[model samples]
Target: MTQTENSQFRIECDSMGEKQIPSNVYYGIQTLRAIENFQISGLKPLETYVDACIYIKKATAIVNGELDCITPETSKAIVEAADEILAGQLRDQFVVDVYQAGAGTSHHMNVNEVLANRALEILGDEKGNYKRVNPNDHVNYGQSTNDVIPTAIRIGGLLALSRTLHPALDNAIAVLETKADEFQNIIKSGRTHLQDAVPVRLGESFRAWAQILSEHQNRIYVASGDLMVLGLGGSAAGTGMNTHPKYRDRVVEVISELINCPLQPAPHLMAAMQSMAPFVNVSGSLRNLAQDLVKISHDLRLMDSGPKTGLKEIQLPPVQPGSSIMPGKYNPVMAEMTSMVCFQVMGYDSAIALAAQAGQLELNVMMPLIAYNLIHSIEILGNTVAALTDKCIQGITANQERCLEYAEGSLALVTALNNHIGYLNAAAVAKESLATGKSLRQIVLEKELMTEAQLAEVLNLEQMSAIRPLGS
Candidate 1:
């Protein structure tokens, strides 16, 4: 070919390559590409980002309907498109990196493009025909990225709680309840300062675990309620600029119906846009739950420490080869994983807290990091709770013999005997039994302190299992 023909071919190829792509994601693509080019932060978009996108689409459709900016047919099409996206139909079409630091402008645009493309499909038109129904002008007619992005983040966080975290916590509570009922009759030595201190039933310890988890469940719900109030109608700077008068309330109503939850408009849009304190509060609550989980996991590990040399009151399910060099050894791998997840949640909480502090006068610029860390915390905690419940808690069985052995060895039970006899006499009986490696029954028999029938009535396991009255 001649030079002119070759140049024309090159130009044709370039135009084809560019034309095949959509322009709505210019900001999203640029942010993703620049971040990839720079390689600054190792963060990525979270699953919560998808939920946020869905919220933006839904809210936009509602606002557009109220403003009458688009035809009724176009508005219906937009709503349907948003529904599809929320149901996860457009996940793959979103290819932008999640690590951008522009307050989720890229994420907002991604949702807009998906809805526009989907709306175009509904109209039998091509994707880039903004003349028919533009993603920004028609779909996102009454909102700004600032308000839309934060609203999406809040909704996404709620979605994670409803779908993943809440169910796992429910399962954990069920496991603890089951264990509590199972261990009701098993007496154990309650320890203080790593030394035996008092007599207690094993069921009581499990009950404590159940109560702690139940309380956290309530806390998570409260934090989720705070998130339900959204900033959708606030527009660019909370003044409702460029938005129709009825836009804010109408959008919130549509979103509430779509999400199947009551979502109120934020009372202070400027504060909502400028401060990430809500995310911080939610993350802090999640971290508090994580800390509790860590303590419970640690206690479970300790309770099931060893089959031979340690307090083997319970047995955990073996998931993998526990050691490389130590043959026939199994480890508490589930507990270790749970501990690590808790620590990660703590670290994510710290990141979210710092990001909240970074917010300034009119808008918080660090929303990328805030969104990243908060969603990461939710995901990790959700997975960890599920794993702990399924792999560790469900299959655990009480080591009855070990529990009995420890209970029998504990001198704290002497307190019960002291009520019937003198305290000094009970201590003497305990000391003699330990010194002679004799059972309590045998020592009591040798001492002849009471008739055999009397001893049987006083030392009965049923009576011993009864929770002693407060002061007694």
Candidate 2:
């Protein structure tokens, strides 16, 4: 053949090649090549993406079956194929790169191609044949990239919460609880402005951490519930223009059943398509969780401050050598990593907010960016929480000697003795004890303020460590 004819034949053959893609899809090598060429975000397709593909396949089959677009046999074949993909059997067939800018068109096509191929296999037909089942016409019958992308995002978000975030949060809570119980009797000096303020049991501090994490668990649940309310039937522009009325609710039911997660339709399709309020809310909660992690990591670092001169109230597990020059120096590397994760989540939150703000009237073209940011936030937070709980929190051991030493030297203990003796007299006794290098008990004894028994009764350890005043 001549060069021109040979080139034309090769192009036609490649266009109809028996590749991973199904035949009915308009998306071809050009679309896949464009996505692969413009690699952007470092994140690959996450579990949420996989979950969304499964959800779309199941929901589409149910919708098409209900609308008489496909017979029960066809629906069953499509769902079986989708289940195979969902079970991770056909992952290699999904060949689109992770970074495309056209509102996840590449991802949608990837899912379409994979499902179509699997459905054709179930129907005993070769891949890339539109005879038995077409990718767009049969698989993606009544959906658009707009509705599918967002719905998939919601499904992915919910799955992340259930499978990753909740478990990690639970682990952290368990570690905190265990620490609280272990350190209930260890008294330490509490600091407010980075200066000694009062006496507090080490357990009380851990309990506070547990409480913050529990609150975040609740926040995540609320945010995830918002995600559960999906925009399933809002095809193209929230009008359900080409989709049957029954298709909307039936698809939702199928999705809800397939994922075993409650899925609801939005009351207003236009509002659901145009407003990214759920994303904003979920991202805000993630930011709040990140802020809590920052505070917790900071406190852990401070508590594990110095092996030589700092607070040194608690010791963190040394994962590796901390310093290059100092041979014996160990650092709180897990705590530091936790802090870094917090900053990353904070950045993701900012990205989500910016994407939300950029949404327009009919539909948000920024759904892909929103999904990318939120998934990153969820995965990072999940892994960080797990690391903090397993590596840092569980291994933390209170520095009993240092805690006792600091508590003994702290003047805040005088507050307990002040109630029995007058404040001026207590101050005078404290000043004398410091100057004369004597204990407060010794100063009080020398001044004949009260008998040793009376002093002991009034300045008991229990009184000094109480979280609140005796009654009020």
Which candidate number has the best lDDT?
2
Query: Over the stretch 1-472, how does candidate 2's per-residue lDDT look in tens digits?
Result: 0123333211212343422323434344434554556577555567667667677778788679877988787788888887776777766555555567556777786677667667777888755555577667777888888888888888888877777888999989988999999999998888888876567899989989999999999988887888888787888898997888788888888888878997888898777778888988998999999998999999999999988878999999888899999899999999999989999889888888888888777878887778878877888899889988888899999998788778877766676677778899888887877788788888888888879998788666656776774778
Clashing pairs in 1: 45-98
Give stretches of model 2 more than 4 Å off: 1-27, 30-33, 93-99, 417-454, 468-472
Give the C-alpha miss distance for residue 390 in model 1, angstroms.
1.7
Q: How big is the RMSD of model 2?
A: 4.0
lDDT of 1 by residue, 1-472 (tens): 0123333211101211322233333222333344445455544466566776676676667667757767777888888887776676656665555566467776566667667667877988755555676767777777788888788778878878877898998988988899889888887777878776565678878888999999998998888788888887788988888887887788888778777888898888787787787898899889999999999989889988986888988888888988999888889899999999999899989988887887667788778777777777887798899998899888888887778777767766666667667788888988887788787677777888666787788766557767767999
Worst 10 residues of 1 by lDDT: 7-16
Q: Which candidate leads the pack in TM-score? A: 2
Per-residue error for 432 in candidate 1, Å, reads: 8.3
TM-score (all chains, Cα) for each model = 0.84, 0.88
